[model samples]
Target: MTNSPTPDQPRVIATDAALAFLAEIREDHPDILFHQSGGCCDGSTPMCYPASEYRVGETDVKLGEIGGVPFYISGSQYAVWAHTQLIIDVVPGRGGMFSLDNGRERRFLTRSRLFDGGEACPLPLARG
Candidate 1:
């Protein structure tokens, strides 16, 4: 998931710190993925879980990969976030209750930047 930046490319990315934290988590949980639910309880934060744990429904869309993990968002949320790139970073805090990062003292945070005028459109939304 380490693609060079070039116009609307690589819709999702993780910072060095984020990558390190992800690696740490991966050591314990080999296959994990992330989902940013638009629900109220989580405050729109990205939640990390084992890939087999959370069931991706038909309404969710795969945004892209970050830190070699697949990232997804509800289609409703995707409609609103489609124009921006999701920058996943690590912040000092407890992660979501059901997320893998919960007890790690550092959680995955999302930051975004809008796409440029000449960039290509995002990939086709996939059915979960």
Candidate 2:
């Protein structure tokens, strides 16, 4: 499945790595849910939740699901992302976890690997 964001919003790109990861998981778990949470310093972090219990954030960009997995973007923060295309890639480290990249080389890992079977790396909170 596929969906479009707002007219002014840039297109979201899912990297091959991301697709492969999702496909592997979907083989056993069809109901996969993807979402983003606001991070520290004006950045965002992505998370995958159980399909049975997933909530969409106000600023999330809805990218239709593939292989029964739903995908979304950070609506408010996405605009500020340097690269229009967002690529999800797996970080090369212990505990196999994924990260989000904005195509420009900027990357952010999940706040806690507990959510996605990886190590914990909390994103800095955005200051006022």
Candidate 3:
């Protein structure tokens, strides 16, 4: 059950491969969140966790939903990346040790492109 982005252009989206992988992951853990982790040797990589397992922090910002799961990042990171659209893709590799994609042999990756002129900028802060 993928959720479409609202009237505001989405800040994040998933590739078909990523959506397929996310669907498989959803079978076991029905509720999850994709968090864009902060920097540190790929700590910036996105991590998937069961919704109940991880708590969203104060500065966490909900970028948007991809494949029905809400995607998030720190407000500071959002500030740095607000002009880009996050593209989630699936790749062959071990996922983050703490991310649900771990042990699956395929992991989620983030790619981005700067929004073209005329697209919306600066979405509401701290939206989750």
Candidate 4:
């Protein structure tokens, strides 16, 4: 795994709030893995997957475990995220459903909903 960020940079601050959120997911799916990617914004959003079935892209990366859960960073995105940290939180959403937070100023990542004969989860937020 990459080194932790300097004191001035954003470091993965795993607070009780964040740990509680992770615990909820762990209880629901103990085998899930957490990962982050790069695209628009500060970087990309956190993505969860079934650990047993998770696939890594063809890139060199450092794998680290946080809160006893496996986490991965893509080789290409590592440098950009070196000074970034991720925190988890739940926010109120429409219909009383909660949206996930990555502790950044940006709310979440947005992606295309189109798929090939298969369903994909829509992003929690909309993009311009």
Candidate 5:
């Protein structure tokens, strides 16, 4: 039996294509995680990295999980994106230089939709 996310549980969702891509990469790099940047070098795309390699800091917020992968957002960025649901998908292009998906000719992308006034707000930070 598959364990799907409850209605109010997931703050993030991954497309089938994105999940397939992540599965392929996980074979080589098992401990993988995603961090959606607000905007910078990668233009706010969902960047994938080895779990131990990327350091989640005090300002980061854990939105939830997608495909069993924990997704985080920088606190400063979270403030701006708090009202929406994050949609993680894959597309044809080069990912961030530091991201594991780089050089694969396909990159993880972030698409969002408003929360319909029912979904929970952004997950709280560990400390204010």
Candidate 6:
């Protein structure tokens, strides 16, 4: 299930081009996942990995699904980005170093817009 802001607004969504690219990647790795990087360098890019190779942390926040794949952000990062909606789009450049899309000429980019009053996603990330 996708995590939408305020129960109805999507927290993250993919552009048509990005969705097409995701389809290409899905052909190879049927089960894929995405984690928005919050590191000091190159953190804007969304890193994708096969479901078998990566692990979702207990503190990670599931922003939502883009192109039918789960997208997550770290709890700390989510705290800083709570007022915005993550827009997953395609850009011409290298993807995250370890991401499945590394070699592809196109990469998944994160663009965000701040939520207006009453539009912010305040859902507490459920943890085990």
RMSD of each: 3.9, 12.9, 4.8, 14.0, 4.8, 3.9
| Candidate 3 weakest lDDT stretch, 10 residues | 1-10
Model 5 lDDT on a 0 to 1 scale: 0.80
> Where does candidate 5 stray beyond 4 Å?
1-7
Residue 73 displacement in candidate 5 (angstroms): 0.5
lDDT of 6 by residue, 68-105 (tens): 89998999998898888888899898888899889888
Candidate 1, 59-123: lDDT as tens digits: 88888887788999988888888878889998999898899999889888889888766453756
Q: Per-residue lDDT for 9-102 in model 3, tens only?
A: 8889888999999999999899999999787777447999999999998888998899889999988888889888899998899999899999
At residue 21, candidate 4 shows an lDDT of 64
What count of clashes does model 2 give? 6
Better of 3 and 4 by lDDT: 3
Residue pairs in collision within model 5: none
Query: Pick by lDDT: which candidate is best?
Result: 3
Residue-wise C-alpha lDDT for candidate 5, range 1-128, written one tens digit per residue: 32343456567888999899989889999887888876666655888889989888888888887777788888888888877778889999988888899999999999988766444544677522
Among all windows of ten consecutive residues in candidate 2, which has the lowest summed lDDT? Answer: 112-121
Cα lDDT tens digits, model 2, 1-128, are 22333343323345566567667655665666666555563343556655666666565666445335566756565445423444455444332134223332333333211122222122222211
C-alpha lDDT of residue 112 in model 2? 18
| Global lDDT of each candidate | 0.83, 0.47, 0.87, 0.46, 0.80, 0.86
Candidate 4 residues lying further than 4 Å off, grouped into runs, are: 1-13, 41-44, 58-60, 85-128
TM-score winner between 2 and 5, please give it: 5
lDDT of 1: 0.83
Worst 10 residues of 6 by lDDT: 1-10
Q: Which residue pairs show collisions in model 1?
A: none
- Runs in model 6 with CA error above 4 Å? 1-5
lDDT ranking of the models:
3, 6, 1, 5, 2, 4
| Residue-level lDDT for 34 in candidate 5 | 87
